[model samples]
Target: MEQVKVFTIDELMVATKNFKEERIIGRGGYGTVYKGLLPNDQIVAVKRSKFMDEGQIEQFINELILLARTKHPNVVRLLGCCLEVEVPLLVYEFISNGTLHDHIHNIDGASWYSWSNCLQIAMDLANALTYIHSIPIIHRDIKSSNILLDDSHTPKISDFGASRLIPLNHTHLSTVVQGTLGYLDPEYFFSSQLTEKSDVYSFGVVLAELLTRTRPLLPVRQTDQNCNLAAYFIQSIQEDNLFDILDSQLIVEATQEQLIFIANLVQRCLSVKGDDRPTMMEVAIDLGELCKQPTNLSPIEREM
Candidate 1:
């Protein structure tokens, strides 16, 4: 509800208690997030990057510009940014809850990971993607960890550091490959041609996670090997073992019709050719329709 245009580093220092370790809320490759209290008692999440090299300053500025222009309920709101210091800082509205990753993995702060909740989260993220893509922007990185949750479990898509704005004249952009390993689009990985479909491909991995409630990467044998959940999912589906990969909790709660519908949708999103994938807007609409369908499963039934 509170909006901060820009705050001085001194003010942020006061708010975050001089960046005390106790105020640190989250940590990632980009930087750390701190839970801060502003002058008017406004609660916010402060993102401070460790370093911005010669090549990354533009990406940082691009992130700030994109965040500044974003306006959506599902996308995290960027209140302001501080550029006075060597390490730029971004202030965002605090999401009281946690990331979708926590909920899906039953990590600390996990509330309820019911089928309905997962569906709603997917719908929310899809809607956020739709809005951003309509602005002709590619999130570049889309994953459960990037999706934050509020007190009521509403999702807010965050982290625009890897985003790129596509010109109207172009359908895709040629750029360096950047994204998480598990969710990386195969076509983009090979071609270095970034497009909106790349996001769709990553989102398919999210949908797969929702179905299976497993990390995108999985530990294998004692040899330190790992399994890629995306390939695992496609293999399972193709072998007619889709149900085998489903989250145990969802099996009893989800309907056969709905699961098949969503699984089919995921297949399209994960299509080998980006040209065959659905647009974010189309995916958003389909997910919205999926979640809105009436169900016989009760709340207690879903929780089990």
Candidate 2:
């Protein structure tokens, strides 16, 4: 196993050219990410944290330790970190294609976003979740923006600043709520008790987003009044208009049977009660079986 290197602040400074604005690749509530090139010509993303407050420091340490132990193909690799700085910085393997959110929202990318590709991405994510959850880690925040894609469009789960590791003695951890708005688990939000199912609920939102290619908290269509994708998706399924809310591309390319199967799975995942949701392992198995089914699309459509 490769050890997580403790990088020097000076080395990171040179890699990012003294944190030049031109090197910036991403920005979030936690901090900014810069494209960095190490001395050995290895490309990486350097995350410069924003603060060193008690909570921030705790989160920083939590992420560092958890990521250091995690190993999964669909999980972003933490190459190294710099703790010599005031706020500290995390170094991650650079993923060239950007985030899943960027691709889904981009007209050019979404135009060719095939259902088969979407399903495979979902499977990759589910498997990643299964691995982390088995390690007893709750990703607390699992959303499209936190999911990065490589050149091959493979999804890798990222941003574990809000994740938690559950102890073997405890069934759940009672902690302050933390996660993306639309993807947050209602049961955990209300009770302040975090569990693995919280990730399942969040993953449900991501799967819903993938199938519809719509923002989790925004109206997909002007005629739609609902802003919450979870509620809107459940309502659509309950009202027997599931196909109407799905992406036009999905409806034409995916078999009706598979669409319904996945939609039902999504509904179960979004259940209000955590116990009602399926485990990540179960979800991965279901998706794997679905992917094995023959494609309904023609060769041209499959290539889309």
Candidate 3:
């Protein structure tokens, strides 16, 4: 594992052109992220903390320590940090292709990953979650926006601000539940007891997004009733309308066996009880296998 370096804020400022508006790539609850070039000519994403509160500061150090200690092809690599500034900053490998959310939401975007690409990305993401789980860490937030895609559509899990490091002997932890609204695990939401299974629930939602290309929650303008995608998805699955909920492109491009296999897998991930949900390792293996099935065949050819 690479030890995180300490970079001067001045160097960061120079690389990001004094943090110009155009350099800003993303904004989140944690802070604003700016795209920059390192003194060594390496492109990086600089996450500047907006909140000076103790909690926010802890998340910064927590992510730094966790990311420095862990290394995986599917997880974003933390290059360094700058603590001299009023707000601390963390530098990560810059992924130019943007986030899974961007591709999923912006259907017309040039960076959109195809059905096959989405499957491959999910496998990589599962591998990342499994790696972290082996280390006994829980990524409290596991949403599309937190997942960055590389140029080849390879997904790298990012944003560990809400991550928790679990002790070796502990089964779960009690904390004030903090996660995105729609992707939040109902079990964790009710009990405030978090475990790796919470991440599974969130991953399930991600799979649903990939399958349906729909937001977890409906847009405010769409209806007075907020749409719960998972609930609707599960209902559709029970009613044998799984294929109906699928994106039109996927419906035609993906084989029936392939879609059914993934629907079953996602269903397992979204199990109501945490204990009932498959572990990240199991989920990843299943997705890996699912991705291997041929997708270019016609519907009749697939059945034959």
lDDT of each: 0.86, 0.91, 0.88
Cα deviation at 146, candidate 2, in Å, is 0.2
lDDT for each residue of candidate 3 in 133-203, tens digit (9 for 90 to 100): 99988999999999988887888899998999998799899999899988999999999999999999999
User: What residue pairs clash in candidate 1, if any at all?
Assistant: none
Candidate 2 local distance difference test against the native: 0.91
Candidate 2 residue-wise lDDT, 1-304, digit = tens: 3479999999999999999999999998788899999999999999988777877777778788899889999999999999887766899999999999999888877654988899999999999999999888999999999999998999999999888989988879999888889999999999999999999999999999989878899746653667789999999998899998899888877889999999999999999999999999999999999999876868787699
Tens digit of lDDT per residue, candidate 1, span 143-255? 99998889889999989999998987999999999999899999999999999999999999988987898888876833233387887777778889889889766777778
Off by over 4 Å in 3: 110-112, 219-226, 298-304
Error of 1 at 82 (Å): 1.2
Model 1 lowest lDDT segment of ten: 218-227
Sliding window of 10 residues with minimal summed lDDT for model 3? 218-227
Each model's total of backbone clashes: 0, 0, 0
